[model samples]
Target chain A: MHIPDGYLGPTTCGIFYVAMLPLWVTAAKIVKKTLRAKQVPMLAIGAAFSFVIMMFNVPIPGGTTGHAVGGALVGILLGPWAGCIAITVALVVQALLFGDGGITAIGANCFNMAFVLPFAGYYIYKAISYNASIDAKRRVIAAGIAGYLALNLAAGLTGFEFGIQPFLHKTASGQALYCPYGLNVALPAMLGEHLLVFGWVEAIVTALVIKYLQKQSPEFLEEGRKN
Target chain B: MSKGNNFIEYSIAGALSFLKESIFADEYATKEGFLQSLDPRIKVITFLLFISAILFTKSITISLCLYAICLALAYFSNVNMWFFLKRTWIFIPIFSLFIAIPAIFNIFTPGEVLFTLKLLGLKLIITQQGLFTAVLFVTRVIASVSFAVLLSITTKHFALLKVLRIFGIPQVFVMTLGMCYRYIYLFLEVVENTYLAIKSRVGTRLHYKKGQQIIAWNISSLWHRSYYLNEAVYNAMLSRGYTGEPALLNDFRVKSKDWVWLFFTTVFFVILLYLNRK
Candidate 1:
């Protein structure tokens, strides 16, 4: 789901950077007000948790293992605002220190994973799990559904971003200067794989984690539950 | 862990060290190399400038030239040529192969036909324009990735974190990021130990359902540990006179050499931009 450096034009990257600025600021502000001064350590640990969460390889069927983005899981655990900041920090670390994601595309990658995934997942889970007790099975189901849709939604946006590159930036001879795939190809390619494979991985992991937390420590789920 | 075909296998060591090999090794950053001598802020800014020039230019020649300069920078920075090559090449093929190769065929970008090949009794036309587009996309990726990787390897991670101030990232977030960077390794060790215990206890063959249960247990326990640690860390910080506001030390200074390097990079950037417009 991480867009590499060359796939998107400078304009697209610039636009995302601008677009994410307000979201990030808003997220930080809300997180501070919500968590108070304690937000610092909470967010830092959350960031580390989210970062290492990606390293936990879950065994799937057919003898293969997959890692979850854990964006949705974090959002459900820490609330969307805090989750967004934590995931953003993790992503920044990944891009800058690890070079997993593109440096120029940090804004774009964070927008997809940090903002879109968390907000989408948190809200979807909240909407579905409304009024359910912390220990309810409905909360676990909600988490799974949220994970699947959140990942798909983020993948869709990424595909759209990549698809527009040819139209936005191309040579006079119609050669694509950046990502060459049009919306037709990019959208289906991104959405297809996620819908089939990764979305399920995310869903099972998110659901399993929620189920465990519901049993082990239901207070973790209570933060995002408050009206 | 399993040698069997259907056993649930997780390469914990490989997955955990995936980032550590690059971040923690710091083999090149410690060396008294050319790039290591410069301020990290200057190096990062210069790398960003080079990347911007690469992105702006539509010319494959310009991109490749910048890519060459990136390699030279890495060489001067004391990064091993083979190691650097492996890093760049590994990422590029997995990424560009999917996105770039498709662009080379006539289906994506129809243009003057360069050649045609029969594949499975079907004619596939390769176009000059298509080839140019693909190569341009790839070289842009290579140039940008090389420079980004170059900056990452030559500078210490903490210095790079402090350099985030230049980009206007909040001190708190920077502090958080630094903490996150530090704790990630700690958790990595925990994860390593946990996996090792699991392997020792369960051996190679485990059912997929059991594996899933183990992962859930692992994640939840991790959350519990991090939760307790966060609270303890906060109290520790309070006892040590840490306020809500964080103060990160800036030990970087723009020396004469940094200025000289900046001047040359600016000149190269301008020339590249001019060439890009043509």
Candidate 2:
């Protein structure tokens, strides 16, 4: 759930950007250390791919359409820093060029899907990979599950920011910062939608991406690949 | 194997190239520039304060004032006006629709209609207050979106991550984000190269139904590879003596200019608040 510009107060919006600054620096250093000249073109293409992939709608169980951020997919293949940068780039372009999300809301959205999800997904994948001694098949399954679950966890955090955050200003006893009912309503809806409708699509996409990289570009698995 | 080794893959490749250069490169450059200047700790705390203020404000006047301040910051940052406009447009429909849909319920429930109309099975009453509330909602959304974009454009993603770590946000979270940034684009390149190949082979009649399936299959494989990649990265980190907590060299220096800028902006917002209250 991308928090639109006005949905959050100015303070919350501004603070998150501030909070995000150090991460941005670390990201830059990581890129500087890691990115090769040959990798640049690939990264650009990946950025474009992000745009194209998000545009295509996948069908859910009911009638609604959904798409994957594919954060983990990218993180798993290229490394999480590149994945974060690529997705943030994609999201910024989408917001600026397409207007799907607001310019002001870009930080929040990036924080949610791009910054949070990919990183979380990467670690989860790593933790699982570390513990297991599975072959390719099982590894792929673990990656897929991790990717899908990570996205939902990211969504949950977004809900917490948008849905539960305002309530924090309210007394702990609940004196109505905005509307308790509204917060109550939004929390479940966000979690439900992500879990049921979008989560499965994400899982499927995550699974497919894991499989592709395993078969085509196994170097991507250098860290987690069990000999 | 990946396809499209050369630039001559697709007829429309030029368009994609242009978009890639204009949108992607410029954004990375911009992100790099803004994030370099501020103290991550200060930035993070300031941002938190701003978010709280924005969420706390319900008054249209206050919201507008906050929005104006955001615009002023954007202008100062030398961010292009058109760039800002273009980004904000995407969310307008969704934002408006989200607010407007709920407002429909507010119409009939208000009892007294400032304006009434006949509609399908329900009254489309627009009370002055309801209308005002609607406008405020939209305004708030716009304000928040604009500010966020400005922040992202100005700041680098790495800086933000470091700030998160420094601020006692969990290490796992920071590590995850770091890894995500490391690899996202490599995955994209794979997809892009594959698509280019697919496009060349499939030709102009290539709106195949199974394209999605192909993409999904590729993504599945990508995930498998990514896990191993993560492990390799971890080893690299370990080899480099990466302890649980990363060491920072204290690169940020708050110049007099930053202090001046921060002070002026804070004062400006305060003035706006005063005016709104008056």
Candidate 3:
């Protein structure tokens, strides 16, 4: 799911960076105003959690293993703003430290995982879980649905980014300069993997985590509400 | 059920080995080497410049040459050659090849047919233009990833975060990054121990459903523990007079050698850009 560099042309990368700059600024402002000094540690720990959560290999049904991106879970636990900031930090570290994602494509990666996934997931979770009792099973169901949908939405945006490359950037001879596949190929390839596999993993992880938190640390869920 | 147990066992092994390799890389960063001797701030800027230059060029030759430069840099930096090659090529290039595979068929990018094959009463043609396009995409990705990996392996993680702070990145963002980097390894150990404990307790052939629940339960417990840990850490910071700003004692000064390195990189980038445009 991490888009490496050279997959998207410079034009696409630049556009995403431009689009994300203001969003990042707004996120920083929101975090500054709402995140208290004590909560600052929570934000840092949340980022750390997102970073290492991928290392936990969850066993799926077909004798295979998968991991959740944890973006939606972060958004549901921390508010969207804090989630955005936390995941952005994780993404940047992955790019710079592990080269898991592209350095130039940091903005694009963050736009999808940080901004789009968290905000969309957070709202979906809020809308579904709204007015439910704190311990309602509906809350867990809402988290599952939100996570599943958020991952698919992010995957769709990523597919569009890859799919548009050939159309928007090509040589005079009509050869693709960057990603060679148009939307017809890129969209299905990205969405298929997520919809069939990773999305469900995310949903299960989110729902189960929410359930456990409800039993153990319900206050963690309430933190996002205060924000 | 037995197969599921094998899958869990193999994945745990895979995850552990991968973590071990990264820990090795972390130790390598502190070793004396060519790239390590350079100022991290300068390294970050020059790497960004090189990456930008790579992105602007459409020529395969220039991209290959840039990739070669990265290999040479890695060699001079004393990074194990096999390790460097494995790190760079194993993930990005292979993944890009899969993405680029469909592009090589005539159905995606139509051009002069290089080869034709008959399968299932349907013709599959590999176009000359399509092959070139795929190679171009893969080479560009390889070059970019190599430089990124080079930067990472050659610099200490904390020093790299400090460099970001020196380059005008927001203090809070840098602090968060620093904290994240520090805590990730610790948490990885916690996770490893948790998995080990689970593995030890289980007799064999753990049900997939049970495995998922256990993993989820561990994650939730980790988060719950982090709540108290965060408060404890913040209080520790308060005792140390941390006022939302982390202080680093390592002062960075631009020595003459750094200037020379910067000048060389700038000239090299200009030359590459010129050749790329031509």
Candidate 4:
């Protein structure tokens, strides 16, 4: 989910920015080394694709519809580094253009959605689907499970970020200056929703997309150095 | 003939309406207004300073003052007041309220009990300090989101990208951002057409399972097509003498009015910071 500004104190936001700086540098290096000049457009298109994907309404059970974040799907198609950059670009655009997420919290938001979600999902998918044939049903299951788990992981981290604010930042009289909930409250609130609803939607979306690609355009998956 | 089918159709309609509204919102950014008239770089820097000032201060009075300033700015910028308030308050307050609700309960945040009640053999107390903290949290979040919404609704998206470039964002990052902005509209069109084509063929209702499968297939095909499209786009750029870096035709010039605005904003921020320390 998008964490708006003022939810986390400046200290937490600052630490995340510092933590993300090196990862961003490394991602840029990887993108430069692996992708050729012609493939640069893929990065841009991928980011745009991630942005537009959220607009799509996916049919779920019980006659309702929802959307996926598409971070894991990007990671599965293009490698995690590319996914990171693409999703990060999309997040930046959302903040600056639409004000969906906080500008100050961009670093923390990207750390969750772009870095944590994609990389964790990608690796989890790889680990589960390893040794299975590319067309195996197990691979689809792997994608779904990866999506489910990666989202929860990001959710848990977000909870930690919000939960710690009360403990870490407080005034002289012990009133919370930022988010007021402790870990006990924040973690469960975030984790419950994702684990119950959004996680399943993300899982199904990732699995279905991967399955379609496997049937129609398997080459895209194999050629892109997704591992 | 099924309720599920109607729900799906309604959701698709809702999605399209939301897409149209977003596009409509973009039209406001191009209109001549106070914020629209400022160089985007100056607007970006000044708004960012305002956000930082809001974040740095713990005083609720200062936060509300900043929120009022954002409202004043929006008023001067020719933005619709109702639209601005609705955009800022509708989502952020409700979302923050959900986050802040638990803070008001005594179990999570300890303080003097404002109200105590026994329900189902359980003691529930709303704490005075918790209520204060929750309100403070909501106020700060509201103030922060107000500035963000003001900045976005007044500044054109392309101008925002250019401001990012001016801030020394990496060329690759800026390039990707520029291209992404350019292509989002095209991709949205593709998505709309794909859905419309499916609707035309299937009429009002189709088997739910089949509909999902078709949507998945469409997404995959879109991805595949995008690969080829990227190559074509790159070639087109090359043909037009495009280099690696994007070159914009409009040069940014900050006039004396921008400096005056900047000075006043800086003075306000300094005063807020001083008052916050007190």
Candidate 5:
């Protein structure tokens, strides 16, 4: 599902990179301001968590194996910013050193998996928590939903981006060349398949991790609590 | 150690050049007519729409045609086309597998043979539909992969996240991405140092047992280290007047250049769509 370069029209890739630039800059600034000497170990652990967890490649019941994105897990343990940065670095290294993703495609892959998923999941968790009426159990549920949905949303974005090229064709024959709604074809099917088959894993993993983080060290999210 | 360092020599140069280009490239230049300066939000939306358009397509001929146009677009960007092609290579193996499976399945399944052979009482038949479906899948996959690459390489990360946030993406997720971007370098620096240290210790013997164990230990230790680091970081934030409301950059205005780019792309897509129908 990770896009390689050249498969998409250049316009699409160029635009995506353009879009990514600002976010990258902002993230850099934030890290510079917030990352102190003490956080180095946590950042390292988050990176290690990302790498080790991904290495396991959770078994999807249909006989295909898909690894945990671990976006929310990292977000829960380390602040989302740390989680996102750690994952992004991990992906970049994986692509460059291991040849896992295309070098050209790194921006898109990073944008989708590293940038989009963790951020989306984090806020979703936050939004749910902010409501005074919500109990811890609800917050946990919200966290679960946010984490699961964020992963799928990232997958959905990939599908949507991939879906863009085919819309250019007009004829029935041309129509044959592309999928009309990338969302329907890729997202729902992929998300649906996961929902029916793998959603539980996503939810469970997310819930358990969030629970542990909250219980073990409530202070980890202390900064986030004020927000 | 030498071998490891040597392996990365080629890539390090490429990375350096890209960094140079990113650092030095003139922000004002419009190499590709006008698409370069579009607001990140508009670009993000447009990119998403473009991807959806491609996904809607299923025909090989259309996919090929669309791919041709994208190639031309890349040329306009003036980024090295070779670099672009190299990036797309990652998808070939995966797509090849995708194409091969259905063809192989067709041969094994007991279907009316469009083409058939009998070997030792086992039938090997390829159905026309199976072959067509496989080809169709390949073209679609190829088209999608290329499209994704096209969007990512040219954009920066910051702009994309802003768009995400503006589009009502949760702050937690947005902050997560921002922090991730901020500190990725910190991790990389650590990894690079670790690699160097490991190389110094295990010069070339590449002792299979020790090397393997070291790799495993690295993974575990890395986790422990990062965990402690997070605790320390949180405490630091507390001392430094850190509240939950993330400090954000001032909002950007969508310049006229951005509108022009958006208009042009929209028009171009509309035209391509019209032509495809014709």
Candidate 6:
């Protein structure tokens, strides 16, 4: 899911960077107003939490293990705004130090996983769980569904971004200047993998974590309940 | 070390190995070498110029030449050639080749037929434009990644994050990034120790249901611990007269040689641009 360098045209990457600017600013403002001096350590620990979350290998039905994005879980656990910043920090580390993702694609990758994934998952859980108690099974169900849908949505947008590269940047004779796969190939390939395999992984992880935290660390869930 | 039959050991080893890998990579930064001596801010800017030159050029020859420059820069920086190659080549550029494989066929790209192969009772045509496009894509990816990897290896990670100020990033965000880097190691240790405790009690190859339970326990316990750490850590800083604004150490001093090298890189970039036009 990490888009490497050279897969996106400069224009596309630039647009994503421009688009993410205001969102980052707004998130920072909201977090500062809410957490005050606590935002630094809070967001830092949250970011580290999300970073290590990806290292966990959970067993799925098929005997093979997979890791969860944990974006939605973070959103649900630490409100969406802080979650965005947390995940953004993690993505930056992954891009710069680990090279799990491309430096140029940081903006695009954060927009998808950090922004869209968390907010979509958070709001969907909110709407579905609607006034349910912190420990309600309904909340667990909401987290699961939110995780599935949010991941799919992000994956779909990633495909759409890759699909448009050929249309936006191509030679006169139609040779793609960036990603060669058009919508016909890119969209399904990205979505198929996520929808079939990753979505389930995300759902189970999100739901299970929510379930565990509800019993083990309800205090934190109560903090998330505030905003 | 990254893979194993036991998920517990795998996760623990993977997380701790990242810590070890990071420490190992920092060795290159500590060496007295070309990139290590330059001010990190300047190093970042010149690397950006190199990447821009690589990305903007359409020729595979030019991209490969830029990649060679990356190797040369790495050598002068005291980074081992094999380590650098393993770091860069085994990354996304290799995966980019597989992605390019499909793009080289006639079904995805239509162009001059370079050759045809019959596989599984089906005729496949490889197109010249498709092949060139694929090669160009892979070359560009490799060059860009090499430059990025070189920059990171030659500069300390914290210094790298601090240089984000060069891009006008918010001070708060930059501080948080530094903090994130700091505590990631702490939690990584906690992950290792916790897994070790679990393995001692339960051993490897737990039931899948038990694995989920343990994973859930890991996630939830980490969250609880992080929340508690946040409160304690913030208060400790406050007692030490901490405020929102940070006073950071400013140790970087630009030398004349750095300026000369910057100028040389600009000239080299202009020459590449000229040749690109040719």
Q: Given the true complex, what DockQ would model 2 score?
A: 0.16
Look at candidate 6 and give me any clashing residue pairs: none
Q: Is candidate 4 or candidate 6 better by TM-score?
A: 6
Between the candidate structures 2 and 5, which one is better when assessed by TM-score? Answer: 2
**4 against 6, candidate with superior DockQ:** 4
Please give, for residues A58-120, the per-residue lDDT of candidate 6 as tens digits: 876645688889989999988999999999999998888776778888889999989999999
Write the number of the candidate with greater TM-score, choosing between 5 and 6.
Answer: 6
Error of 5 at A17 (Å): 23
Per-prediction interface RMSD in Å: 2.3, 9.8, 1.6, 2.1, 10.6, 2.8
What tens digits encode model 5's per-residue C-alpha lDDT throughout A26-109? 765676578764554344446546744454323333333344566765665556666666776667544433345544566777
Q: Which stretches of candidate 6 lie over 4 Å from their true place?
A: B1-5, B274-278
The C-alpha stretches of model 2 lying farther than 4 A from their native spots are: A5-65, A69-227, B1-44, B92-94, B101-112, B119-122, B170-176, B204-209, B231-245, B264-278
Q: After superposition, how far is residue B162 of candidate 3 from its true place, in Å?
A: 0.8
Q: Write the per-residue lDDT of candidate 1 for residues B208-228, one digit (tens) a residue.
A: 777777887888888888888
Relative to the true structure, how large is the alpha-carbon lDDT of every model?
0.85, 0.58, 0.87, 0.83, 0.55, 0.87
Location of the lowest summed lDDT over 10 successive residues in candidate 1 chain B: B1-10
For model 5, the stretches where C-alpha displacement exceeds 4 angstroms are A1-227, B1-34, B91-105, B108-126, B206-209, B231-242, B260-278
TM-scores, all models, native as reference: 0.96, 0.59, 0.96, 0.94, 0.53, 0.96
Worst 10 residues of 6 chain A by lDDT: A58-67
Model 2 chain B worst lDDT window (10 residues): B2-11
How well is each residue in B117-225 modelled by candidate 4, as lDDT tens digits?
Answer: 7889999899988987898899889988999888888887777887887777787788789898777767777877777777777776655566567667767888988
| Steric collisions counted per model | 0, 119, 0, 0, 79, 0
A-chain TM-score of every model: 0.97, 0.84, 0.98, 0.96, 0.79, 0.97
Task: List the TM values for chain B, per candidate.
Answer: 0.93, 0.74, 0.92, 0.88, 0.72, 0.93
